[model samples]
Target: MPTVSDFIIERIREWGVTRVFGFPGDGIGAFDGALGRAERHDGGLEYIRPTHEEICALMATAHAKFTGEVGVCIATSSPGAFHLLNGLYDAQMDNQPVVAIVGQQGLASVGTFNQQESNLERVFADVAAYVQTITTPEQAEAVIDIAFRTAIARHQPTVVILPHDVQAMDAVTPGAEHWVSRSSVAAASAAITPPTEAIAHAAEIINAGEKVTFLVGAGATGATDEVLEAARLAGAGIITALRGKDVVPSDIPYHTQQLGLLGSLPSLHQIKRCDTIVLLGTNYPYGEFLPATGQARGIQVDIIPEHLGVRYPTELNLWGDVKATLTALIPLLRAKEDLGWQEKIAEEMRGWEREMLAQTEVTFETGANPRKVIHELNQRLPENAIVTADAGTTADWFGHHIRLRRGMRGDLSGRLATMLAAMPYAVAAKFAYSDRTVVCTIGDGAFQMLGMNELITVKKYLDRWENGRFIVVVMHNDDLAQVSWEMRTEDGNPLWEGSQDVQSVDYAGWAELLGFRGIRLHDDASVGAAMDEAFAHDGVTLIDAYVSKNVPPLPPHITVEYAKNTAKALLRGDPSELAVIRDSAAALVTEQVERVKGALHLGGRDDDGPR
Candidate 1:
């Protein structure tokens, strides 16, 4: 007889779920037993086991982001189940569809303080949009159906808890009664668009201004043609939020890079100079970097109603899918004959590109500049490569140096801003598309936290992939670089060793121990060779890149007050003061030289340079 666990496996399969990320525990043994049976008898779900429950959920979220499907993860009750909170929060914050199936203590032990019997519903309430507990075999399929449907339709994480005994019960059919509802595996959604009059009004607002700019986010990922057409009609520059960095190709003349802290100087200048702002599919959350309230005419459109008009004081708000809305709004906009505004933005970007490369060229006595390390790797990224960046100074390099060409994919923890997600994200990408080369760029601090353990996961599955082009780049700086920068740049505080310093590890040595190719990135000269060797290898490779700890990730637009505060913090006996000042001086010199060369257009353009 089929068990409740078997029924669940079949139901999720019917829902088009092909992979499940999980870790085994005593409470979930029944499900494991059933998984074994399904694998032996019928072609069933692909079970991916991570080193821990947290990484399991993280892989599931990454799967959703890369594959555009509902991601599923399983965990045991109590501590194992609780560990999924952080990763679930990561999915929820990023608006990914994930369903977590966790085990609970037996129903007979309910409310009796049994081992690992704490209420999980209360814990998951905040992060999950839907949570349900299965008590009987008859109730299993219905709950699984709703869980997947809700997660996919809402683009939110959902939870399903199965009691120990319930998972082992013999499968039974629900009766034809009112409460005993049976469900199907079908999932459907419609393309949403706003009213015709509202779209016309939004176009009007966007058309009325002389200097217009489009601020796009993740929602605009597939609507590149529409975004470009709209920008062309309005003679506008396009600025992508961090989440939407890959939405449009960087080489587009008026396509300025990301906005805010990790963004480009061109993006900052464009935002400040624009008279009209078209906020589409982005809740960027940085008001200071946007046009001041009432400074620009705002037109916002988003599928989620609550997200509209929150970031800027928008004059027109339309609730619709970005592609459909833009498609409707395009015809209403009158094409502007003068392309001067866009040309100016394109020229500024041309200048910023030189400054970006020059930032990488600076020589540092302490270590290799991280920007240069990232830039070298960026240059080698294949046309179809997938890259993931962790949160830290590495993110600054990823944002500033890496430019996405057509057909390439890249992502990170954009909203939650969590650490230790990059490695798992890369792992999932490799698992989903084994034929594609996957790259993960992370810092040493995150590697020690959890990225190191995920290495074991990669080694375990080395034989499964069709191509073995997985590469992990570790920025080996012995400090929590981003937080350290925040303390000085945001609060004028010196580096606190207790909070910021992390002990150095021989990352490449560890990889060699795991029977994989590992190389130590010793100097600037070897950057290109190391990357070539890693990419050409037929096995997993690790590059332990030595990077400067004191190099600041300067924002695009630096204010005098910000400069004063940073100077004040470093001058107040900060441990890395001398190196920080040295690097800052090198950076300033690079900027000035590049600015002049860009003005003369004498450095000559490299078709290969990041746009």
Candidate 2:
């Protein structure tokens, strides 16, 4: 008879899972043996082994984010299971579907102080939508089915603990008597659509507004045309959250890039001045950046009812598929004759674009400006590139730069806001879409934490990627840049050397050691040439750019409170205070100079300069 592990593997394949990320250990030796047999027989399943179990879990979440599929990860019991929590929680917070399978000490060993045995159900209680342990062969299929279904329906991670003995048992069918159940693979959930009345009410609110703005988030995926149609009818501008960067192409005239701390000036201007706002499938958490309560009449739409009307108070909340709901509402919205508001939005966006370009021209005495690095790289981004970023000033640069065409894909840990996930995310993106070019940016602090080892994993799979155009950019600043700035800006304190300062690593050299092309970038003049060389390479490459840590990631609209705190921080004797003031002054002056240049170029048929 075939072992239970064989049945489980077959069941997973039946569920349409083609890849699994994991690490090996004796606790999962039975399942590992089954995998070996499957491979021998050409089971069409691919197994990826990462340097650590944490990476396995992170890659699983990333796979789901990139492909919109249920990601699967496997690991051993005890310590391995413990390592999965960070990435599992990342999935839980970001609302991605992931399934984690872990091995356990045999069922008989439990409750006897057995080594490597603990109550896994309790351990996974907080992070999983569904957690189960198979006691017999008869229970395996039904439980596995439930785990997948629950993860998909809820967009959450689920767990399955397979004891050693249970894995070794022979596969058997459930009997007609005595608490036996059976299940088969099926669809996870039905698509949701709002009631006709709700859509009509939402349309009424938008029709009544004079100056309307739309906020789109990740939930707006596949609804780009509908969003554009609704905005065109209402004479509104569109603002995307960071997660929704690729939902709409950046070239659209009225599409304000992003809205939040890492947002553009036009996004802030439009949000502050608009008389009405429509929140479309975006759960943007920064409430302060949104219009004040009652400042604008609001309408919200989302597939998940729980996400509706939470970020901003809405006059109407419609629970439905974004594309379907927008399609329904589009017919009801009237085409506004006056294009004045959209024209103003377009003009402001032009000004912001010029001001942004001025920032990239800044240079420090010892380090290159990261803004310039990303700015040049953005000019060469492929239309179908898959981009990922870690949490830090890296995100600030990525959010402000890196404009994506419609077909391109990009994401980072949003709600979780975790560091060191960029490399794993890019690796998984390449695995899911091997033909697409994958580019990722990470800060030195995060790169040192886990990325050094993940490079080995990249080397192991270098020969497998169909396109082989993977590039990882590391910002080598020799400091915990984001946290150090946060201390100065948020806490009104100086940058403490004891905690914020860190040793820098030769990221490019490390990449070369792993048989990949590597470039060390420290000057602004070489950014464009370096990017061209890296992108043209056939295999993987790493760019280690030494960037200035003193360049502040300024908020789009600086408030009095923020300015006051920054002054206090500077007065507190920050070590990089002089560089901070110099860069800030130079950037502000340059932006003003560019704005003066943009004034004459706007409000006409002058498309003379690059947008």
Model 1 lowest lDDT segment of ten: 602-611
Q: Which regions of candidate 2 are displaced past 4 Å?
A: 595-611
Global local distance difference test of model 2:
0.88
**lDDT tens per residue, model 1, 476-536:** 9899999988888888888899999989999999999999989999788888899999988
Can you list the residue pairs that collide in candidate 2? none
**Total clashing pairs for each candidate:** 0, 0
Segments of candidate 1 deviating more than 4 angstroms: 596-611
Please state the error at residue 485 of candidate 2 in Å: 0.8
Residue-wise lDDT of candidate 2 within 1-611, one digit each (tens)? 88999999998999889999988887788998899899899864699999989999999999998888889999999999999999999998888889999999999997677999999999999999999999989999889999999888888899999998899999997776678887879955536778889888988899989999999988888888899888999999999989888888888888889987899978987888899999887888988899988889999888777888888878888888789888888999999999888998888787887788889998877599999998998999987998898999989998888889889999998888899999899999999999999998999999888987898998898788899999999998999999987887788898898899879788899999888999999989989989999999988899999988888887776668777877888898988888888877776677667756766566432322222
